[model samples]
Every structure is written in structure tokens, then in C-alpha cells.
Target: MKLQQLSLFLENRPGRLGAPLEAIAAEGINILTLSLADTAQFGILRLIVREWDKAKQVLEDAGWVVNLTEVVAVDLLDRPGGLAEALKILEAANLNIEYMYAFSLRRGDKAILIFRFEDPDRAIQVLLDNGLHVVDGDELMSFVP
Candidate 1:
């Protein structure tokens, strides 16, 4: 399936990153994986957190602008060449990867990689056809260490 990701535009200053996390924490939400991209003046914080609705609400309530995007979460091997193999599959299908980040638990062996693609539906089908496990948003929410 797909994962719900929160993207927040923030100022490139001290403690800017902590503000969103603090707001999310107030709502008792847990962050699963995150990616941050910044420019000279501003930054974008992309996060995969538990309780998507509440996390979004909390951030908005705290006067932060946020957007929701659907991304694919695939199970990844915790070894070398694992990611490359998956990328090859997508490449073979002409799928373009916009961005990606890794997710791993402290006590778990398996890892998850969050991917944003130009054509998510087709990418999902390609990954599934290649025998890769796509994680659902709900399943990721209940994931524990």
C-alpha cells in the first residue's frame, strides 16, 4: 500500500527541527522515519509518524504549515547491495525515484525504505511483481521495536 507522510516547511534556524517533533510529541505520536532537505533560507521536513491525523492536527495547531503525501514503504534487507537491487528493479521499469529514506528499529533485523516516486502506482506494481513487500500505513503505525 502507501504511507502517509507529513511535509513541513521550516526556517533554517536553531531549534526549527525540534518544534515539529515537540508538537508531535505533545500528541503522543512517534516518528518512524524522516528526511530533511534545506536551502539557504528554509527547509522541508518530511516525516513518517504514527497517528498521522493527530500529528498533522497538532502541527497545524501550533501554527506550522504542513502537507500530506503518499509514499511507498518497502521492506529492505539489512545488507549490502539490497537497496541497489530494489533500485535496479525500479530502473528496469523506468520508474524515477524522487526521494528515499531508510527506517530501521533498534531490535529488528529487517529494515524499511520509504520511497517517493514519479509514478507510485506503477512503482508499487513493479515492486510487487519483483516479490518485494510493500508496507501499509496502518501496519507501520503498529510497528514496535
Candidate 2:
């Protein structure tokens, strides 16, 4: 299964990051998970949200450059080497992960990892074939605050 992720290009300066976040908050949108990677001049803020379309709209209307990316959410055990085990499976299948971020729920002994892969559909198949649970879009939204 694949989910849509929001990527925002923000300048790497004080107060620049909060503007987009505040815009989304004003509309009552919930951020599921996010990752920020920066360079000298700007940063890429990758976010997972349930209401992606609305979030994108608000950010863009506020003058932020936003992009939609297809990403996969995979469920893994919340234990040591759980990620390593999944990585080994992808390695055997020759699937490359471009980037990933993870979050663990307080109620379950499981972790949800958002992954951007070179081939998302193929990666999902490989993960399923290897007995890994691939989180679907609806299931992911259920975890949103």
C-alpha cells in the first residue's frame, strides 16, 4: 500500500518553519509525522498528514512551495533490530529506500515507518512477500491525532 506525503521547501531561517505549520493548524489539520532535512540555504520538510489535499492547499495559498510524494508505510515490531530485519529483506530483493522516518504508538508494541523507495509498488510487494505488514492509507489515517 502507498500513501501520499507532503513535502514543503522552506528557507533555513528562524520563524520560517512555523508559518506553514501554523497555517495547517488553523485549518484543524493534524500532522501524522514529519522529517526536516536542511542545507545551508533551505530545508525540505516532509510531512505525513491525513488531510493532505487541504494541508497542501493552505500551505500553497500562504506562498509555500508544496509537493505531493507517494510513500509507503510499513509496520514493524518495536524492538531492537526490527528495522534491520526489514532492511535485510529489501536488500535481498534489490529494493532501495531513498529515505525513511518512524514513529511508535504508545498503545502498541509496534512502530510505523514511512518510507520513500525507488519503486514503491514493487517494494510493497516485496515487503508483503517477506511477511512484513504494509500499512495501508486508511489504516495509517486511523493513527492520526
Model 2 over residues 21-131: C-alpha lDDT tens digits?
999999999887889989999999999888899999999999889999999988898899999999999999999989998843532888889899989999999999999
Question: Could you tell me which residue pairs clash in candidate 1?
Answer: none
Tell me which residue pairs clash in candidate 2. none
TM-score of each: 0.91, 0.95
Q: Please estimate how well model 2 matches the true structure, expressed as its whole-model Cα lDDT.
A: 0.89
- The lDDT of each candidate is 0.86, 0.89
lDDT of 1 by residue, 1-145 (tens): 9888899999999988997898798777878778998999999999887778889989999999999998999987778998899999999999999989877562265678889988889999999999998988777766653
For each of the candidates, give the backbone clash count: 0, 0
Cα RMSD to the true fold for all candidates: 1.6, 1.2
